[model samples]
Target chain A: MSLTKHPSVGEFLAGCEEHVNPYRPARLALCPMAADAEISDVSTSDTAREGDFVILWGSYTQIFGIVLKHGEIANNRFGNFHHDEIIGRHFGSRVRSRRGGLWLALLRPSPEFITQSLTHRTQIVYHADISLLRALLDARPGHIICEAGTGSGSVSASLSRALRPNGKLYTFEFHEERQKQAMADFSTYGVLDVVVSQHRDVCNHGFGEELKGQVHGVFLDLPAPWAAVPHVTKCLVFGGKVVAFSPCVEQVDKTATELRRSGYFDVRMLETLATNWGVKRQDATKKKRRTEGTTGTTAAQEAEEEEPKDVPKTSGTGEQWLSYQMPMRSHTGYLLVATRAPDGD
Target chain B: MKAKPTLGSHVVLRDLEGAQKVFLLSSGANRQELRMGKYSAIPLETLLSCPYGAILRREADGGWQRVRHSIEVAEETVEVQENNQHLAQDNSAQSLSPSEVRDLKQKCSGSEVVEALASNSATFASKTKFAQEKYLKKKAQKHVQQVTLLRPSVMELCETYYKQSRNKVCGLRYDYLSSLLCQADVRSGARFLVLDCAAGLVAGAMAQQLAGLGEIYRLFRGSYPEKGLLELDLSESEKSCVRAIHLEALESSDPWSSEWLRLPEAPGDAEGEAIAPGRAEARLTRITKRHNDFKSLEAKAVDGLIVVAEDADLCAEVLELGLPRLSFGGRVCVFGHHLQPLAALQGAWRAGNFVDVRLTQLFTREFQALPLRTHPFMVADANLCEGFILCGSKVGEAEPQEAAGEDSPTKKQRRS
Candidate 1:
C-alpha cells in the first residue's frame, strides 16, 4: 500500500511505447488498468481491478492504496484488508478484515478524497479554493492551463479532472524532490497523461517560451505571485484568466495592482469560508418540560436541577434533528481573479 | 481573438448602476430592445458587430454609440481631511437646481452632465479625495447611460438571476454552485443525473463543464424549464448533451414502458392556423433524441447525482430512486434552503450505504481591494443564508455476511 515501491517516472516512461499524453485515447489504451477494457469503459466503470487505486475509508480514518500484488495487505488501525478482497469489489463495498473482523468501505479515488488522504509535502489547497478556481478559470475540455509551484499536487488533481478527456496541464514546481514526488503521485492517480510536471522556478525563468500565448489559464500559488504576473501575461492568451492564491492581504493588493497594470480586467478578490454543520437529534418532550419548569424556579435551583442525567431514551417520533456550525478554519487564502484584456485597449 | 456577439445570440447588458438585463442581439422584425432608464430603449441590433466586453454609451441624440477607448480619469493627490466634522449638513451644496440638471442631461452627454454636476457642487472642493471619487462615481452612475456587453458565462448569468430574483435560482450562490460541481467531480465525458428545479441553471452549468463530451439527464417534474438554459450561448454539441426527462419516467417500474416516456402530441393548431412544417419536424426530432438519451441512460450508471429542490422530502425521494443508478464512489449533492430537512437527511443517509457524509454551509465575503483602501464591503445581502448542502458518496449494498455482523461493537461505536 506504500508508494515507495512504485516505479520511478523514468522507469515507468521507459516501459511505454511512446510519450504519454493522458488526454489522448491512445495513451489510455496503454494504461495497465485499462488494458483489459476499452478506455471509455475502464474510465467510467466503478468496479475496482488490479492496478486500480482505491480509498479504504474507515470510521475514523481514510487510507489510499493500489489494488495490486495478489497477497499484499493494507494494514491500518481498524483492520488489515487484503488486496485480493478489494480487487474485484465495487468501489463502495464494505470489506471485513481477515483477523480483526473490522470493516471499511472501499471507495473510488476522487480529488477530494485524495486531498484528505494524500501524503502532504506542503500546505495544499482544499476543496473550497479549488472549486472556485476551477470555475473562475473556466477550466474545461480542450483547455491548456499552467500552474506554478505545484505544491502537493492538490489543485493539480482537480485541474486534471476539470480538463479531462483532452485538455492538458503544465505544472511547474521549483523544489526538485517535491516535483518528482508530485509526478509519481499523478502517475499513481492515473492523471499523468493530462499533466506535465517540471522542475522550474517560474518566477525567475517564466513558464517557458513554448507556452507563450498558448495557455487558456494561469494559476499562481507562490509566495510572491506578483513577480510572475508579467510572465503570466506572456503565456496566457488574450481574454485568458489568471488566479493568484495569497494568504495575506498585502500580497493580494500587490498582485491586484500588478494584474491591473498589466491590462487585466475585472480584477476581483474573494474569500471562501465553509463550515461543517453537526447534525444531532434533540428530544422535544424534555425540552418543553424544562422550559415550563424554568419559568418559576430560581436560577440556582434550575442549575441544580440541570445536573447530569442518564442519556435520555429516544422516542424516535418526538425527536428532531438540528444542525449547528462546527468550529472551522477562519482563513485559507485570498483568491485574486482577473482576465487578460486585448492588447493596447 | 475576442468572441463577438453573433446575431440572435444572447448577451448580458450591464449598466453603470450595476443592474443587468439579458438581451438577444438580432435585427429585422424580431429585433429586441433594452430600455435605458425611463427615457430611451435601444435596439440590441446595434451590438451584434461589437465583441464581448465592448462598452456602448447613449448619445445626446438617443442613439447608441460604442466607446472605442476607455477614458482613464487621473486622481489628483490632495491633502485630505481625516474626518468629515467640518462638513456642513445643509442641503444647499449644489448650485444647480433639479430642473436645471434635467435640462443639462437632455442637452449634453453623460460624462458632460457628470462634469457639470461635479463643478456645481459647492462642497466638492472641500471633500476628501476618496469622498470626492465616491461622489463622482455615484453621480456618473445616475447620469451615464452606458452598458457593457458581456458573454453569458455561468458566473455572469448566476449573478444576474441572483440579484434580480434569488428564488428563481433557488438562492444558489455562485460559490456554492461551484463547490457542488467540484465535489461532484463534474467534467468532460462524465455522466450525471441532475434534478434541477432551479430553472435549468444547474443543468446549464453542468453542460458548460461537460463541453459536449458527456451526458446530462435533466429530470424535471413536468415540462422542461429552459428559461435559464436559453440564456447560455452553448454550441449545438453542448446543447445536445442535455436531455430532459420527466421525473415520472424515472420513477416508473419500467421507464421504457411508462406512458410518461412517450412524447406528447404537438398542440392542435389554434384558430384554424396550420402548424409550420419546419416546426413539426423539429418537434419530432427532439422527441426522438430524448428517447435515445433515455435508453442510453437506462443502460449505464451515472458518474454523479445532483438534486436542487426547495422541498427536502422531494430531494430525499429523488435520491432514493437515483442512488441505484449512480456509480459506486459517485457523489450525491442535495441542496436545500432550510437546515432542518437537510439535517434529517444527513442522519438518514449515514445509516445507508454511503460514506463521507457531510452537511455543509458556505459563507462568502467579497472585498474591494484598492490602492489605499482595501476592506470588506459595508453593505451585506439581506438574506445571509444561501442554503445547506448534503453531500455523500454512494456505496454498494452490504453483503449477507456483512449485514449479519452489522450489530457488532463497531456499529455501536459509530452511533455513539
Candidate 2:
C-alpha cells in the first residue's frame, strides 16, 4: 500500500514502531525521498486570511492556522493542506514552501529560554541585556541559581533552559500578581518543575526562608537593594555569585557600601550601553526623477493606457532603498557583579 | 539650543554681592540641592527641576541645601549671569574632551563652562586628593583597627592599608571599599577582619605620582586585574624602591602560603621583654623601634597582615571573633588554612562590582617576586580627576552602580 493513501496513518505506524523497539526505525528506514516529497510541495502566501494553515516559527511547533472543520483543507496563503500534513512531523521539522524554492523550518530553542518569551509583568531584560548577562554571569547548565523579582519569568526561563535536569531555580517575586503570571508562563513552558516562584519581598524577609545557603548564584532586580543586604547573607553560600541591577548611582553607592560591610570579595560594578548606527551610503544628490503632472490627474489610467510600462529598475529592486540600523530594545537597568567572600571557604 | 545637565559634571557656587562673585564650592552641585547653597533647608529636588542654570546661592546648611528655582534676591545684592551664549556657540562642536562634554550636556549644557571651571585641573587635583584622603580615613577609622564591636576577616582589615596606599595612587580606594560594602548579595551586619597579603607601602614621592591619576583607586589598580597590577608596577618603579621591591617579591611568590621567606627575630626590647608571642605584642614594640625592622618586613598588604612564624607548624591565634562581629558581607576573607574552616560560609552573598586587585613587588634586585591575595573591597570615589583610594572592607559591603552617568533616556538621546 502507498504511504500517500492516508496522512495520520504514517504517524501511527512510526509511533507504534518506536514504542515497540525504539531503535528499529533507524535500521529499517526505506525511502528518504518520500519524506521530502510531501514537504517540498508545501507553500505559503504573503497575506494571511482566516481559516488558513499558517506556520509560526519560534520556540515550539504546532500546526497553526484557523481550525474550520475536521477534514476540510484550510485555505491559506500557502496551498490548501489538511491536518494530515502535520500528523507525522516532529515539532522541530521544516516543510517546503509552495514556491518550491524557499524553505521554512521550526526553531528549537536553546535551554537558555530567557531570550524568547513573553513577560507577564515587571520589565524583563531585553534581548541585548540577556545576552550580556549570560556572558557576565558565566551562565551554564546544571548551575543552581536564585533570582529576585521574577518579572514575567523571562530570565528564569532562560536560566532554566541552561540548567541541567538536576538543577533548579529559586525565584522570588513580591507582587502576587506577577508571581502568578510567572508561574503560569513557567507551567506553559513545562519548566515549572525546575523553577519555584515565591511571592515574598527580598527587602522585607531576606533570602532566608526560601533559599537558605543552597543557592550557587543570585540575581536581584530591585529598588532599594541595600535594605536586603542583611537578608542576602543568610541565603548566599561562601564563594557564591551575586549580581544586582540598579538604575541610579545613588542606589549603587548604598548597595556597594552594604557589600563591603558584608565582605564579598572581588566586587566590581560597571555599565554597558552600546549604540548601533546605520551604515548606508549618504549620496545627498541621489534623488528620484521628478514626475511632472503626476499628482492629481490620471496617473493610474495613464499607466494603464501606457500598456503597463515595466521599468527595468523597479522601486523594490532600486539602489535608493532605506537602510536602517536600529538600536536593540533600549534601556535596561545597569548591572553590578560581586562575589561572596572567597576566603571564607 | 538649551543645554542639559550631564552626569558627573562639576558646578561652581558663587555668592553675589554687587556681582563681585567668588566661587563657594568647586565641586559639582549636589543633584538634590541644585540651588540650595544659600538656605538652611533648600530642597535640591526643587532646585534640580529649575529651568535656569544661574540662581541665587543659599547660605544655610540644613535641608536639601539646593533649590531648583532661585528666589529673586534683592536687586542690589544679587545678579545672575549665565554663560549660555558660549555653550550655544559650541553646540555639537568638537572640543578637547568631547566625551566629558557629552556627560555635562545632559543636565546643563549651557552651564558647561561653569562645570569645567569647577572641575578645572587645579580644583579636581586638589579636591580629588582631599576626597580620597577623607574617604580612606573614614573607612580606615570605621573598619581598620577601630573597635567595630565585630570583625569580618584579617584580609578585610589588611585591605584597608593596601587600599589606603593604593588609593593614594588611585583616587578613591576607600570609596571603592565603601561601595563594595553595600552590594546586594552580601549579608547585612556581617563583620570581618581582613588580612591583606599584598606587601607595599605608600611613600611621599609615590603620592606625588598618585596626584596625576583621576582617582586614588585608579592610581593603585586599573579597571582590570592585569591593568591595575601593571600600573602599580610602573608607578612604583619611579616612586619608592624600598617598598616597591618588597611588593614585587610578594607578587611573584605564592601569596597564600607561609613558605616564601622569613625575617630574623628583632633584638631584645629596652624594657627587657622576651620576643616570644604571648609576647609578640611586646616584640612588635621593639621591632617598630628600629626603622629597618619594618623595612625588611617587605611588601605587606592588608591581605598579608597576618604575621606567620617561620615554622609552618606554629599556630598563631589570629582573627578570633564571632561571625556577627567579624562578618562583612556575611563572609570573611581567610587565607591558608583559614579558608578551610569557613567552608560552611560558601555560597552566594550580595556583592557588586568587585575587581581583584593584584600587586607585584621586588624585594631584591635579583629576586623579584609576586604574592597573591584577594582584597574584597569596592570603589566609592566618583571624582575622575587624580588617582585616589578610599577604604577597604572589614565587616561591610559596598555596592557600585553603573558607571555611565545619566539616568534619563531623553537626555541620553540628546547627548548622542
Candidate 3:
C-alpha cells in the first residue's frame, strides 16, 4: 500500500521547482565532526559541489551556504573562504582562508540543522509542533497531503520529508513571491520533487477537483479556515484527517463547530509544546577513595591525589548522561484534528 | 485504508452520555431496521452505506435524509452576552411540563422538539445572541437524537473503557501513550520488547503502528489476558507477530522454551498435537522463529524497548536483565505511576552505560479552545493519578576510572 519512491534528480526536476547549484553532486554527504577531525575523508564522485547547500563550522558557530565555483567567498566572523576551496571537497574536509589562519569545517545538512538555519519568508512552524501535527494527521511515509498557507515552508519542509519520495504535498500560498521562494527552498533542501507549490487561495476556489476524494491529510493555517471546510472535505479521502492550526480560540470554535456538523468525528484539539533539552555529560571518573590509619595531612594529600580527572572518559556520576530543558520556543498554535467518516450515512 | 462501513465491519456507536459501544454491522439481526436502542431505530437500508460520521435524520414519514460530508455550519457570529433581565432563572423559562416534553420527544426528533420548546419559551427573545446560542447548544447536546459514528482507535477505546472502570486499564493517559510511542521510536520492520500493562491499549497502538512488518514480544508478569485484546481489532497475522512471554521466562537463559515462544499447536482432532511427530515438528518451527528473532535482535539489537508495567521494580529488572535484548543506540523507556520507582531505576542504571536517563511527567491538559472563553476543562479525570516515564538509551558503557594514586585499601601486621 506504500508508494514509497525516492524521487531521482531527473524526475525531481520534471514538475517541481529546482534551485541553482554551482556544482551538481550526485548525493548529499554529512560530516559529524570538524572539517578535519582525523576521520578518514574518502573521496567520491557523489561529494557536494555547486548548487548543493553546505554548512561551515568554526569555534562551535556554523553557517549554511550554497556552493559556487565562481570563486565566491563565504565570509563570517571566523574569516572568509572561497567557494572553489569547498567545491568537490569531501563534506568533512577542512578549508582555510587565503590569508588569516581562519579554519572552517564543511558539512552537509540535516533536519535538526535545517529547522534552525532555514531562511524564512514568513514565520515558520517549529519542529515540535510539526511532529505533533503529523501525529494528529496519521501521517505515514506515502500519504497524499494538502497544506494551505505555506508559511516559509518550515512545516512544509518537514511534511516534504514525511511524504518521502513517492508521496506528494499540494501546498498552496496566496502570496506569489513567497510561494516562489518556498519552492526554491524546497529544491535547495533536496525535497522539491516531493512537494508541489500552487500559487492560489484555497478557501475561495478550493484545492483543485483532481485531488478531491484522494487526499489522505489536509492542514490549514489560514485566518479563515472555516471558510475552507467544505473544500477540505471535498479533497479529503474517506477516513482521512484534517488539521487546522489557529492562534485564537474563536477560530478553533468556529472550525470545530463546522466539523461537528459534517461526517467528521473524533475531533480533538491540542497545543503542542516543543521542549528542547540540553545534554551534558557529568563528571564520571570515580568516587572518593577510602583508607584507614592515614594522618590528616596524609589523608588530605591522598584525597587530592585520589580525585580522578580524565577528560575523554565516558560521563555521568554513576550513569553516563544528563539533560535539562533548553531555552527555546514552547508555545505554538493550537491544532484541531478531525477524521472524515469511513462510511457515508 | 478506505474504511467503508460495509457489512460485518466493526463500528462504534456513541450515546449522548459520551459513552461508546462497538459491534459488528449485521443487517440480518434486524429485518427492517438497524436496532440501536429499545425504541430508537433506523431502517436497515438507510444505514447500509452511511459514512461512519454522517448524521441521518428521520423525516415525518418513515424515510431518512442525510447531511453528509462536512456539517453545514451557518456562518453565525455572536457578540458578548448582555444582562439577563429578560430570562428566567431555570426551567421556569419554559412553559411546557417535563411529561409533556417527553411525549413530544417520542413523536418528533430531538432537534424538532428543541425548536418547539424554543418557540414556546417565555423569554426566548429577551436573551442576547450569545446567551441564546449557548443555551441552544447545551439543549441540543442534552436532547438531540444526533448519533455520531466513530472509527475505533486506541484513544477512543481507552477513554470509553476508562470511563466504565478506570481501574481496569490502570489510568494510562492518551497523551502519555502517544508521547511514549514517539519517544520510543516504534516503527515497522523492527522488533520490540514491550512490557504493556495498560489493558492492551499500549500494545494495540504499537501493533497497529508496526503494520505487520515487525514483531512485538509482549511480556507479562503472569498469564496473558486474551480478552484484553478483544477490542484491539488486530489482524490474525498481526496477532501472531506478538509473542506472549511470561516475565519469569525472560530470566531463563534459553528463549526457545514453551513459556517464551508459545506457538499454537497444529491442526488435530485428537489431544496433544495428534502425534508426537507433529509436536516435534511444531517445536522445530517454534525454534526457527525464535532463531530468526534473536539473530537479528542480537545482531542489530531491538529497535526499541518499552515498559508500561505498574510494578515499580520491573524497570530495574528489565534494565539489568534485559539490557542485552536491546541493540545499540536503541531507546529504553519505562512507564510507571510514581517518581519513586523511576528514582530507584535511575540509580540502577548508574553504571555509566545508559544515556539521558530522564524521569518525565507529562500534563495532558484539555482546554476549551473557545475565544473569550478559552480555559482548561474542569473534570474529575484531570485529578486522576499522574504517571511518570523514565527514558534512556543503551550506548557505550565505560568502567568507572579510579584515582591514579589511590591504591586498594591494605593493612598488614608485621612479624616480630
Q: By DockQ thresholds, what CAPRI class is model 3?
A: incorrect
Q: What TM-score does candidate 3 get on C-alpha atoms?
A: 0.66
- 10 residues in a row with least lDDT, candidate 2 chain A: A17-26
DockQ head-to-head 2 vs 3, winner: 3
lDDT of 2: 0.35
> TM-score of B chain for each model?
0.89, 0.18, 0.77
Local error of candidate 2 at B130, Å? Answer: 5.6
> Native-vs-model 1 lDDT?
0.75
TM-score of each: 0.86, 0.34, 0.66
DockQ value of candidate 2: 0.01
Error of 1 at A327 (Å): 1.8
Question: Which portions of model 1 miss their true places by more than 4 Å?
Answer: A1-45, A60-67, A282-319, B35-46, B68-81, B254-257, B262-288, B405-416
lDDT of 2 by residue, A260-297 (tens): 66775445565543322221222225543345557665
Largest lDDT belongs to which candidate? 1
Better of 2 and 3 by TM-score: 3
> Which 10-residue window of candidate 2 chain B scores lowest in summed lDDT?
B361-370
> Native-contact fraction for each model?
0.42, 0.00, 0.10
Best by TM-score: 1
**Candidate 1 RMSD to the real structure:** 7.7
TM-score on B-chain, cand. 3:
0.77
Winner by DockQ: 1
Please give, as one word, the docking class of candidate 1: acceptable
